[model samples]
Target chain A: MTLELVVTLIIAAAMFGTGIYGALSQTNLVMIMMGIELILAAALLNLVAFWRYLHPDAIEAQMFVLIVMTVMAVEMAVGFAVAITRFRSRGSVEMEEAQELKG
Target chain B: MSVQVIFLLAFGLAAVWFGIVVFRTHSMVRSALALLFSQTAVGAMFLVMQAEFLGVLQIMMMATEMSIMAIFMVMFMMDPGGLGEMDMKHQRKLSLWAGIIAFGGASGLALFGDWGPIATQIPDAGEQVRLLGIELLGRSMLIFESAGLTILTAMIAATSIAVQPPHRPKETPDKSKEPYQVHNHGGAA
Candidate 1:
């Protein structure tokens, strides 16, 4: 296998591991956010790697990624806004506490 | 060794990592994060398959969406400060059985899957862009422009709704004003 593929594989592996660890181990909301960010970074890395290696001609995917980035920015802003309102209503961000009505 | 073997190895390792993360983490946020990572690695596989457009979209959509969701959950959940211990609820036998079933199913699928032929000609990013523009907006400039306008309008609306004055009503100037007075009555003994 080429070195590029090797490195890409390694990175992908590390990303998956980190994502799993973050998802399984931490209960804090912010830590979970960090874990999500790490996973996203890993996925982006995969995209760039594949773009460089496979489709040297296709620019469509790159543009799509850009659009996705814009969408993500909007989503993050909206999400944070919603979160702020929720925090105002309730004083905590713990997931366990949210199980007040699990009928 | 063949490139296919290497790629397969990467996929396997990444998948295993994803499984481990999903199994180990108790928080929903962490699980989402693990899902994001797993999705991204799949995006890379898309690239390898010569689907550049799909690959990029996968990363952008999956990663960004997951991040936003995580943040939203963090902020809007019962605790804003994340200052409390979480109760980990486990139905022990169910969890173990679920894990076994998932692992077995995944392994079975992986072992039997048939990947199609490797794409011979992968287009460049620029060529793909040109094709996409033409395909999406062929003789339809007005529609595209209108879509852009709609987006602008949405942006304005969202901003107006999200941005608010940072002071409480009581903190602002009090509208009502009256003279303070104390009434006293003398009692005869």
Candidate 2:
């Protein structure tokens, strides 16, 4: 409930909102992934803020942050790999034409 | 406000601004780089908040990750340079409304929620790092190992997916058979 904590939380929330907008609005697969990255970044910001302001002695929060970072790296790798495969097969990475799974 | 709070606000603003820039730019490469700057600003905020190890790790990891992302942006994007001036988004009004609602809801929660007691005493950077290391190796060892395994699996899967299959040679027609061989055993000729 400190000023700093509130400010940090608000900033995280703003990033989260922006991320949602980008992810939902972008037509490209990579752009959507970028939005997801921003969302994850916002989560990381919140985690670190909570650890610093509420439970400074709990180091588990830091470990959680590291795991989240690893997730981000893994996500980027897998997403780009999928993008490359899609590009090779379809000649473009736009998501609008990816309707093979439509039921 | 304390110096730490001032620095925190400054970095926070930078992060938010660059994050907005990520979606606002037309060029894919610029968007990627803007995301990088935004994440770096978040790391700087971590530093301002006195989480030195996490801050350093964030900056270093994001630097390399975002560079690779930028390269991929150039490779996969149809208009990486923004020369085409194509609109890259869809459902703009819906997204805008969703974003506004999300921001308002989250801001309300942050402002009105009761976050109990704040801890004023924080460990120094070195001590925090040591404690984090111990936590990772001690109680959270299983989680750490699982994450490592997951990353390894993801790497292998990505590499396999990205690799092209070998091209097979075309089969040649067999020439051993007699051409137009017709057996006529009738007595008439």
Best by DockQ: 2
Candidate 2's clash total is: 0
Per-residue lDDT of candidate 1, residues A9-35 (tens digit): 455546544543553344444444444
Q: What is the lDDT of residue B31 in candidate 1?
A: 54
Lowest-sum lDDT 10-residue window in model 1 chain B: B110-119
| Model 2 ranges with Cα > 4 A deviation | B80-83, B168-189
Give the Å shift of residue B98 in candidate 2. 1.5
- Please write out the lDDT profile of model 2 over residues B1-189, one tens digit for every residue: 878788988999999999999888888788899999999999999999899999999999999999999889888875634545767788999998898888888878888888877678999999998998899999999999899999999999999998775573554757886454344679477
Q: What is the per-residue lDDT of model 2 for residues A55-85, given as tens digits with 9 covering 90 to 100?
A: 9988999999999999998999899999998
Which ten contiguous residues of candidate 2 chain B have the minimum total lDDT? B178-187
User: Each candidate's chain A: what TM-score?
Assistant: 0.75, 0.96
Best by lDDT: 2
lDDT at position A71, candidate 1: 46
